[model samples]
Target chain A: MDLTFTDAEDGFRAEARSWLEANVPAKPLPSGDTAEGFARHLDWERSLFEARWSVVSWPERYGGRDASLWEWLVFEEEYSRVGAPQRVTQNGIFLLAPTVFEFGTPEQQDRILPRMAAAEDLWCQGWSEPDAGSDLAGIKSRAVRDEAAGGWRVTGQKTWTTRGAFCTHLFGLFRTDPDAERHRGMSYLLIPLKAEGVTVRGVGRLDGDEGFAEVFFEDVFVPDADVLGGVNEGWGVAMATTSSERGLTLRSPGRFTAACDRLVDLCHRQGAVASDPRLRDDVAQAWMDAEAYRLFTLRDITDMVEGRSLGARSSLNKVWWSELDVRLHEAALELLGPLAELDGDAPAAIDGGAWMKGYQFSLSGPIYAGTNEIQRNVIAERLLGLPRK
Target chain B: MRFAFTDDQLLFRDTVRDLLDKECQPEHVRFAWVDGDGRLPQLWQSLGEMGVLGVQAPDAHGGLGLSELDLVLLLEETGRAGLPDPIVETAAVAVPLLAEVAPPELQAAWLPGLVGGGSLVTTQLGGPLVACADTADLVLAVRAEQVVAVPRAALRLERQPSVDGSRRLFRVDWQDDDAVVLAAGSVAADSRDRAHDRGAVATAAQLLGLGARMLDMTVDYVQERRQFGVPIGSFQAVKHHLADAMLQLEFARPVVYAAAWALATGDPDASRAASHAKAAASDAARFVGRQALQCHGAIGYTVEYDLHLYLKRAWALSATWGDAAFHRRRVAEFVLGPPDLPDRPSRSEEIHHG
Candidate 1:
């Protein structure tokens, strides 16, 4: 096994490191889940797009460098190492872009991708509803074909939509054939939030940010051209998106490794190695878990490079990283002690309350992207070949 | 970068696995439990003939001159078989240590015999108990930070029985006066530290195999063993437990493989990587052993059953080199700098007060 990167890849990493070192803001940006923060993040994203750093894995025609997946991973490592702002455009580029690359027509790609890379068309997922959180196939949102209007008449209410109020569009599955089975007859639609009869209300998350929203659609008109994959093939298409969300695309190993380095720094600051053996061990264990995740991803992407399918193995990645994130944050909070409760703006708050805010966000990890319970079932049934019953 | 074994490496692994499947089945393991010193001579000879014993030895010593990456999977196969031998102690740790640092006269005396199954060599790297020291032709013991190689006839061995009966642990009585000094001062310390890392990583690979084997056995048992008029595997609790076990193994395996790579390449972070692998693999195998027994119910609790063989082996090996906590603490020292000692405050203190 050759673990060394090529000279070209190392050069790519050097370029990314230098760019990020110079470009990333000295002070951390506000959380992009908020209105003001969202606007600020758009500026950052536009700078990235202008420099062809926003979507490095995408084609050059779409403002990308046409980098390999390994290079993209390198970019992520360098990006996080410099403490860059979180990608406010992740839902568009990480989750949906893969599905679009696989399913979108050339016309769709040409029209949607460049704008997406430029952060002109912000997007949020609309999968989870009030009643269909885990059982996503039980969605009751309906879309009726309107031949006269040359599109679909969509009526639905989607809840727990992350950054919905900040986004310009929604991508989700809606039932087109009501008489069909649960996973059948659903069409994946991309609906404009500014369309007539559409409404969005921002909801405060546990972290006290309007990071989530409820989007209501009342007979909104969507064009037939916005239908991704096929009219009755939304479930299959959406599964591909979920796997990307669950796998390396959304949560790169660089995020955790950087977090691990930060944790080590915090431990050093707190004199944790001298003060508490248990806490020191916990910090080290968390750091090792992050490294393990990195190693696991290298092996995973290597297999992909070798023409092997990720398949249900993405479930393993989902469960692992989500859980590791929570543990990492927990270790930080433990080091922070009672001061962890203070908010970012509070006087004497530790690291601007980043640990507490991150802990709150990490809670959503296991809950979103399919609950860990559901992922475990998928692992047992699909990967281990156990009986579903 | 490719992060997988080469085709030849995988083929060698499969060859050893197939050989173990035929010769070192559960009965072979059980037979060793009832025999003296628990040494499977024929299997050992076959592995020697396959060049498994000589994987890290130089070609001039009638060996394969391979690195740990080439030998890592073979260690896993041995773990899967619960093979009643000291292959890890002899082949993985001692042979390589001897090849790399032993004096020319000592190498000529032991290297060829050790490679060809004519002699056994075991080292006491740490702790009081030495694995297979009772039967080893040479016992490489550390005396006051110096490595001394002593023949078995010069030492006294008192067997210390292990929970895994196939493994014969012992407390050896030896002296530096009667032994030849292989290395002294800083060189000996470095050799001893390197040997510890090798043993830890080798055991980590074996733990992965043991975990996988137990998980497979439990999965097979649960499918046929029924409760409530259906297969036990149909229960969600059973499925989730097994799933969690599989998850642990899945994540741990890659770490062990990477540790092997780190050692083979002599990476500066090899010690930390080895500790990481041992900590992860020990936890995964122990967790899988618990869940595997729980899923199997009463049948798995019996020694007559084969699952206990792998479970006990995992438990024994989990604590062999250094348990999960020890390795984590070692990694903690690496990542956070050494712990704060009042007498000698290191980089940790600088970071703390700086």
Candidate 2:
């Protein structure tokens, strides 16, 4: 197997690296989880949009360079390396855009993707209700026909709506048939978050920011123009979103590799901690894990290119990166010693408690998308041919 | 770039796997372990005839000239079948080592025998004991960065039995200077270092195979062995355990193959790559082994059953070239810079000797 990049890929990397070096903001943006910070993050995304750097993997019509998967990976590495601000539009561009591209009509793509590229239409995922988390098919949210209101009216509660507090729209699964049981008659609908009957209450993450929210919908009207795929085929359509969540789109190896490097830098700054053998081994393990994740991501890309359905392997990727994320941050925090516990502004806080912030965020990884426990069940039953319960 | 194996390599792996399935059954393994010196002479001859023995030996030595990447699948399949042989040593390691660094006369005396399937060669490259030193015609020993070709008859042997009974290891008492010096100085050091890297990668690949085998066995066991009222695999805890094992094996696998490829391509980071592979594979092996045994409940611990075979082999090979801790220290040195902790000297020596 060839791990080396071709000359063309190398050239693309060089171009991406140079552009990112020049274009990244001179100062760090505010935390994207905060209200004001979210706006600041949007401005940066707008800059990227003008320069066609917001979504390089998308086609030219969606304000992208039409880059290949490998080039997108390279771009991610280059973008994150400069300590660039996080992508506030990732929910729309990375997670939901693929479903739109694959399942939505040409008109829907033209209407939604361009605004998403320009960061004018940030999106939040509407999975994981208070009751229906890992068992996504148990969703109780309903979207009944409202002929008088001119379309479907959605009534439900969507918890853990990542970026829901400040987002303009949401793409969620709504049960459309009263007679159909679980996993049937489900419709995938894209609704405006500011519709008349919608309410979004911010839910605080470990970092004490309203990074996600509990979105309440009471007769929120959604036109028929925005329903994705077929009425009862939402399970199949949403399965693609699950793949996007677990695979390259959500947790790219570039982000972790960059974290590993940052972790090593922190260790070296610790002097004595860097020299401790146990901590050194932990550092080595972190690097090894990140490198392994990188190679595994490459294998995933190759498999997709070869026309093999991702199938159960996406669950494998989810388990891997989520654990690695937790481990790498844990190692970094452990190396930081007593300073690790301090908040960002405390005098004793090390690196502004970035590691602590990251540690908290990392803890959510295995729980969100799908719990690692559930992912393991998928691996056992589907991949290992274990009998279904 | 393609990260998966080529069609040809997949076909080769299948052929090796099919052969082992037919010839290396548990009874044959038990028979070799209980009744003989544990060397499958006939299988060894067959491998040599297939050029598996000389895959890396130079063209002049009547070899296949294949690199570590080609031999890794063969070694993996061997590990899966729990094959009791040192073809990995004789073919994958010794022939290549001798061809690269053996003294001219030593090469003349052994290389032809090696490629022609008439002779078996065991190896001891900085490991504590020699594997199959008693059964092989020659033992390639390394000391002070020098490669020596020692005749099995030249030394007194004390049998050092491994936890895995099929392995026949020995503590050989011989004069280092009395043996044939294949090469000395920096050239010898380079050649021996190369061999050690290849050996470590080969061992890591084998451990991965062992892990995969145990995972398969445990998944099957959990399905067939009922508990409460249904197959235990249907239980959440059991499924989670097997899934975790499968994840470890999957993660370790790409690392193992990438290390093999790095060694084949002579990447400057080949040493670090092999260490990464070894360390990861070691964890995967132990994790899979533990979970497999636990999942088997009562039937797993008994030697009378098949689970013990792969479990014991997993334990045996994880410590062969370099164990998890050993390779982790090496990797630490590579990635974290030189260790400057209080135990720096001891850690340095541990890395240096291995």
* C-alpha RMSD by candidate, in order: 3.0, 1.6
For candidate 2, the per-residue lDDT at B203 reads 85
Q: Give the poorly placed runs of model 1, Cα more than 4 Å off.
A: A272-274, B343-354
Worst 10 residues of 1 chain A by lDDT: A268-277
Q: Residues A1-389, candidate 1, lDDT per residue (tens digit)?
A: 98889999999999999988889988999999999999999999999998889999999988999999999999999998888999989999999999999999999999899999999999999998888999999999899999998899999899999999999998999999999998998989998899998999999999988999999999999899999999989999999999999999999999999999999898878774345878888899899999999999999899988899999999999999999999999999999888889999999997899999999999999999999999999998898888887
Write one digit per residue (lDDT tens) for candidate 1, span B213-253: 99999888888988899988888899899999999999999
Query: Which candidate number would show the highest lDDT if scored against the true structure?
Result: 1
Q: Model 2: what is its DockQ? A: 0.79
How much is A195 displaced in model 1, in angstroms?
1.4
TM-score of each: 0.97, 0.98
- Per-residue error (Å), model 1, residue A52: 0.9
Ten contiguous residues minimizing lDDT sum, candidate 1 chain B: B345-354
**Compared with the true structure, what per-residue lDDT tens digits does model 2 show for residues B271-302?**
99998998899899999999999999988989
How displaced is residue B59 in candidate 1, in Å? 0.9
